[model samples]
Target: MANIQYVTKEGLDKLRAELDHLESVERPKISQQIAEARDKGDLSENAEYDAAKEAQGLLEMRISKIKDQVANSRVIDASQLDSSKVSILSSVKIKNTANGMEMKYTLVPETEADLSKGKISVNTPIAKGLLGKVVGDIAEVSLPNGMEMKFEILDIKID
Candidate 1:
């Protein structure tokens, strides 16, 4: 069974657009290459034909993978989420208990996570530790480097 992924509406649209481009633009180009190669005769020794067939296989695999992703993706409705507790799509402000440093991050789906934009993946250790927690709660997280850290949840916002 494929894992169900939570995504925003924009992400779904992006996936759809990519799929359309692969089918409409790329598929025909590969077909044309194959046809041109076939006209050269010598079916057993045509490198161009083999290359084009390989390219077509890769393109079909990508299209099928994207189709599966689109089929399993579910859009998260931000307005329907509760702001009182941390969850997917929550913007949380936290303070490091050990160093007195403060940082804010928005917990987003894996596909939408961008560190430069202060968006973290919900599957991350920090985000997982903060899940289902409310403001003023402390979260204890274990990092992949074998280090433990504690962070205080200062605020939670959903938009």
Candidate 2:
């Protein structure tokens, strides 16, 4: 069974748009290339035809994967989210115990995650450790560097 992925409405729309583009734009482009290649060729020895066929197969696979993702996606209602504890769609502010530096991150679905924008994927180690933590709670998160860092939750917000 495919896993149900949580995403915002915007994220779901983006996926649908990409899938539509792949099906309508990319699919026809590949077909045209294949037809053009076939016009210049004998069946067994045409490198262009072979390459176009291979590219079409890969494009179809990507379209199928995107369709699956769209089918299994669940849109999260931001207004209905609880702010009592850290969770998906929650913007959390924390202070690093080791350096006393404060940072903020918004937990989002993998498709919507952008580190540069202060959004972290829910599946990430730090987000997983921070989930369900409340203000004044200390969380120990294991980093990719093989070191554990301690943080104190300062606030949680839905917006």
Candidate 3:
């Protein structure tokens, strides 16, 4: 069975838009390249044709993966989620126990995790450890590099 993916409605729309672009725009561009390469004559020495074919293969693979993701993805309703504690779609403010530095992050699905936007994937170590924590709770997260970091939950909201 394929693993079910959870995403926000906005994330699902982005995936659909990407799929449409790949099929309607990129697919035709590759076809045009292939046709132009074919018009150049020699099949065996046609590097352009080979390159276009490779690109087409890669594009098709990407499209397939996105299609699968869209089909399996379930939209998570942020408004319906409880914001009293740290959870997916919750904006959490935490302070590093070691340095006293505070950082805020929103827990989102893997597809929508943009660190620059302060969104962290739910699968991340910090998020995993903070999943059910409330304000004033201490969370110890084990990072992938064999290190652990501790944080104190400062606030939680739905924003």
Write down the TM-score for model 3: 0.95
TM-score of the candidate numbered 2? Answer: 0.94
Q: Candidate 3 deviates by what RMSD? A: 1.1
| Candidate 1 vs candidate 3, lDDT winner | 1
lDDT of 2 by residue, 43-89 (tens): 69999999999999999999999999999999999988789999999
lDDT of each: 0.96, 0.95, 0.95
Q: Which of the two candidates, 1 or 2, achieves a greater lDDT against the reference?
A: 1
Model 3, position 145: C-alpha lDDT score: 98
TM-score of 1: 0.91
For candidate 3, list the clashing residue pairs, or say none: none
Best by lDDT: 1
Between candidates 1 and 2, which one is better according to TM-score? 2
Misplaced by over 4 Å in model 1 are none
Cα misplacement distance, residue 59 of candidate 2 (Å): 0.7
Q: What is the C-alpha lDDT profile of model 3 across 1-102, one tens digit per residue?
A: 988999999999999999999999999999999999999999799999999999999999999999999999999988898888899999999999999999
